[model samples]
Target: MKAIVIETVKPGGYSIINADDPLVLSVQEGARGETIMFSLDPDNPSLKDNLKKGNMNVTCRDENIIIQKGGWTSIVAKVNEIPITYNGKAPFNIQNAMAAVAATSALGLNEKQIRAGLVSFSPSIGLSPGRMNVIDLDYFKAVIDYGHNPGAIKATGELLPHLSVGRKLRMAAGTGNRRDEDIIEFGVILSRYYDHVVVTETDPRGRPIGVVANLVKQGLLKGGLSEKQISMISDVRVATDTILNMARKGDLVVLQADDVHFIIEYVMEYKNIKKRQLSKEVVNDDHSKEGGQNAG
Candidate 1:
């Protein structure tokens, strides 16, 4: 029997829950005959009460995540065991892990299989590209993600504080098609977490070049960031290069990119080329000293 996993609501502007949340209602309705799995959230008592009416077949709760089915409860896995949860620092990811355990348990998967799968899962470029892809260099680290909307930006912002880095730099852009205010909001939200903001253009999607970048710049200015803190580069390649170049040792670059493949390829190539250049410089320096000694 297929089961449903309902994720918990995160904080910030994304946490706005109404009296008749459609997702909650859908979960309630789905519990009529089918097995359903849901995360525990104290804020939504009505949803909890609804689930308590002997409708929900399973539930997942945090703080040493456990999956409960009927009268049987099993410890699925620890939140820290999941790499995506970043050692349980990311609350949203922990909630997601719980939901995954609940759903997989309902699907007849044993605890060992579920634990093994969670441990093996990673959010890498080859696995889950453009969704929190971390690139570690000799000096700095870069995270490329598809955070386009206000809620997504806010979630990323909340996670930034937990990362170990010197300074947080953001290379962000918005589709030219979104509303002016929405585009501006991207910058406004980024200003909270990023030490420096590089505004750029995405696919444009029918709007003129620089329109999206300018809107984001305006939003950054409105969000208390000075012009010096923000830089507008219209070209995606140039913007990517600028951010990579600006990053120093211990710095972190959060890239909210449109063409994720292009960004990844460019960064990899750039790192390789830099290594080659440094090696050549060292070889040339050694040769120059040898020639001077021979001439002397």
Candidate 2:
């Protein structure tokens, strides 16, 4: 199998880096019809204007992508019949998947194999965890997500209600100071969804927990959440424990942390710290490779 690294650039964007130049393929039968919209690379300060003006030269290098407009929407593949669609834009997850499909096809995977590769894939943390499992209750629909940035939070918050109907969504959010303003803006945006909102500490390293929590609360308040709708907590363990205890069965529990492994470990440690009985499986992300298990 050829090595291909698909990087998550944003909520709905990714950059595919191929170590070796692969043969491009043409479009073929049974193509999934999904219209995509894309713009010039956001990272390039100049490309946006260049692309808008209909003139730019883009290439893939340095673990990033460079693109100009007006190119055909197809690739020459290892398989003669199938070609991967090149949309100007696609969902970050879908883009990542496409990169994999393209790489696999280049590595001699047939259409059936490429299709199977795409079908067998699922979302993981870092880009988007995709859909989180939450129950439906009389009060609200609870969801848990790993969205820490403003864009991620705003998108998730807005998208929450569309998942189910007839209920207001609650959000519990916090983040570090390096991205505090952005996180605050995200909270402000999320406050619009409030039946309720809680601003709590999330991985508050080298920063005052109280200060961070307050910042998030203030932003949400600024965003239009009633004062009574928001609360601040400095400790995530206590915060989550309290939220989980009070949240109705159907209410969502969204945990936004920068490091997924750390959150998993923290949850486990919190349980053990509280003297709860350890279940049959408990393994950190790395330890799991050694057959370690994490039982909830």
Candidate 3:
């Protein structure tokens, strides 16, 4: 599919390539246009080779996104300033932001214009829905994303440390028709970063009810997680509720799901429930104090 798409590039047109992905770079060999490459590392061999050959390149270094043309390099924007990168903790989003910069530059946008766009581009549900919407509630934080694919799961694993939380958990599930290996890979990838996993049966289309959850457990074990760290639930909504309730103050819950809108609504529901519970607790405590004073 990629090779076919690259074949459509008109001669002398512009192509933005990810210098870090070897497969993505390989398909560009047949591209009939100028290749503009982007990467997280400026010193990446492919990006370096491109720089030597005078191909336009963009990369993040020293916490800044830099664009290179032949012998010159210019800073475009600070990675921390980009909302989608999660203060430079999310390398995948940084790479994504770099891709946007490279493509916009190809469109002849100036540096000032590009910087403005970068700062304004938010990772909100209203903007890039299900991409990377971090919800900071009164207690725990939830990372909302639709990254269920293998590559995305690995990226999410990498993003764990950057969250700086004491414990990390996720609402996990597998697609119905995919191979068992693929489903297991989800558990393997997530187990590396998340301390606990709540496996849910989201679709399971035709297969048995617990098949997906079972396969994900196998992967989690293979990835070195213990059985105690895993929880298998039959319903996605119930799993979401369980995970949210399981989280304590300073704990992080990963809410990456294919149906992002539904998952987000669940988060909001949990938030409202917590708020009401807190309000009731406060009123009860005040009444108890008044009763103690009357007895005195």
Candidate 4:
């Protein structure tokens, strides 16, 4: 059995320390001498040379990762066909899909099975909780992800422009246990990407109340985000409600939190109430029109 290794991802490049990272080394050693390597297009020479010396197969040089083995080359699946990649708008997910396809191919799954699996797969709260779970409502869109660190936040930011959101809102908080500097870094990244931000508190881990929230606010201010663009609400539920209330049609809200189930339930209830109100308004308008016609 051959193990596939993803050597790099878009926007951020290599996520690990380097190609020779301990995890990479351990995987390479434990694969029973069979391994498959995936690298970014235009191929990293060092990684290519290393894998070549180890007699491992490699995929390189294309938007659709091309895998080669025994003088045969083939693509696993088109990026647009995979729902998780959002039609290739999400580059990170493209890499992920490619990695999955590579592994399945190594396991002797035919192209038809691999393609069928990729197209049928969908990413949602139920399927992949806290990992880019997106919910689209009639009026707006919401993304709930477990993006806590600076790098993760940056990656999330890269996906914003692709969403075609009119106004971006972020529901964010700092963990009580993280360093103040790191918490501030989160704000700085948010300031760069979001149009409006609501800062709140999570479990707090162990830090005093208001400590982490204040630090995040300070970072937003330092990043040149006006106080008008920022709002501080300590309660998670209230903060979620406030941000949703602020959102308008075609807007996007990204919530970085520990639990998104409550927020999702709240949004569903809000949408139901809106639907009922809209139905009543339509009925009233029709009645008024009928009465006017009868009087005339």
Candidate 5:
């Protein structure tokens, strides 16, 4: 559930750990004396054989948690514990930290209570929402998701089709700068659910937005969604409006807007139209009755 890429190690001098069974060990990493500990799973069990070896490349469970001179090993703590601060003091990313705080609050802790729990806590991963935009003009349901990673995209692909039984699902996506290829793989995973795909500009700090969209398109094609199903659009408003306009009353139009204001606007508009139509119909009926009486 965690992804980490380790640095600070040289090539070929380390032994990778390959656990015969991943569940047997209660601890993911073993600690040794103050300076040098087994920072990774012992690959081939021969790492005990070559203790004095220098930096080496280590991989386990598809993660690059290499063993090296530095003391760092990615782990998922089994229970509640203070977070491990990286580089001694820098704080966790804002989104990730907020998510952690929210999680603690969900467990019935109040604001004062949760802050007390954060005295020594820190997080190792960054959390962010995925790109959400419309993909097709021809479809009715506008599909948007928070599938920014490969596993998330795979889950969405498997799950979204059932949600689209009576509607078409449109999609839009792009890659992030930090993990472009990983996100591209996510796009490929989405092709199964998406009726159309739009490659759009995503946030990249100083990187060209168009370049990121291209990478997403490339990955989408690999998932078997065709070029016809994909296009490029920069304006999210236009993309969302296109779907909203096409939606009928019974069809759902999902978009980002002020929830309270949107409800007020829709109710006012609908009520006004209904009142006017009913008033006209009543006047016509009264006129018809008067004309009939005069004729009689």
Candidate 6:
């Protein structure tokens, strides 16, 4: 799939690619014309070789997203100014941004325009739904994501340490259409990153109702997580709410369900309910003080 695109666009076409990944870079072979490569490391061998040949390249240099085409170069924006990258703490998001820079650069947008677009883009329901949508409840936090594959799991795992330090809980589901080994691998990989794992509802395909969830649970246990830290909830909504309530102050809950949009909506509504509860508590405290003073 990767090589096919590169091969087809080989003639007089721009193939914006990620040079940091060797597996992906190998597809660049036999490609004719310009291939704009992007990388987090300015000194990456692929980026360097591309630049040595005067091919277009995008890289983060000196904490800035830098673009160099032959001899001319420009700095589009600083790493800290981009919110989607978690102020540059998320390596995966940063790499994604670099790819975006490569694409925009190919589109002939000047640095100024790209800078404006990058800064304004954020993860929101209206803008980017189901892609790392954060829900803050003024205490603990939760995020809704749509990534289901092992690679996506690993990338999110890479971003875990940079997230709010607290008890990390993940609410996940496995699709029956996926291979059993793939489902197990998904759980095993997540076990390395999260404190607790909630196996939620999934598409049964042809498998039994609980078969897929149990497989993930088996992987979680195999990955060294104890039975005490795992739960098999067959309903996505119930699993989400249960996990949220289980979390204490400052804890982090990551939600990955089949219906990402529904999860986001439910979590947001849950956040609003918590907000109202906090407000009522504050009002009650103020009224208690007033009544005590009046009695005195």
TM-score of 4: 0.82
Model 3: per-residue Cα lDDT over 1-296, one tens digit each: 76777678887788788878889887878766888889888788888787777789999889999899987888999999999888888889899999999989888998889999999989887888787687876788888888887899888778877775669988888887989998888788888888999988877879999998899899999999999999988878888888888989998888867788898888878778888999999999999999999999
Q: For each candidate, how many residue pairs have backbone atoms clashing (under 3 Å)?
A: 0, 18, 0, 0, 5, 0
How many residue pairs of model 3 clash at the backbone? 0
Q: Each model's RMSD to truth, in Å?
A: 6.3, 14.6, 2.0, 5.9, 13.8, 1.9
* Per-residue accuracy of model 1 over 48-166 as CA lDDT, tens digit each: 55346542322334655665434456776777788888887776666566667655765668889999988888879888788777788768888989878887787667887677458
Worst 10 residues of 4 by lDDT: 12-21
TM-score of each: 0.81, 0.52, 0.91, 0.82, 0.41, 0.92
lDDT of 6 by residue, 178-199 (tens): 9899888888888998999888
**Which one wins by lDDT: 4 or 6?**
6
The runs of at least 3 residues in candidate 6 whose Cα sits more than 4 Å from the true structure, single-residue gaps closed, are 30-33, 291-296
| Candidate 3 residue-wise lDDT at 3 | 75
lDDT of 1 at 289: 100
What lDDT does each candidate get? 0.72, 0.47, 0.86, 0.73, 0.43, 0.85
Candidates sorted by TM-score, best first: 6, 3, 4, 1, 2, 5
lDDT of 4 by residue, 98-216 (tens): 66765676667877888888888887777777778777766888788887788778877898888855899999998788888988887887899899999999867888889999999
The best candidate by TM-score is 6
Q: Model 5: which residue pairs collide?
A: 14-56, 16-43, 17-42, 17-43, 83-122
Residue 108 alpha-carbon offset, candidate 2, angstroms: 4.8
Q: On a 0 to 1 TM-score scale, where does candidate 2 land against the true structure?
A: 0.52
Candidate 6 backbone clash number: 0
lDDT of 5 by residue, 106-161 (tens): 34455455545544553211221122222232333343344455654554455344
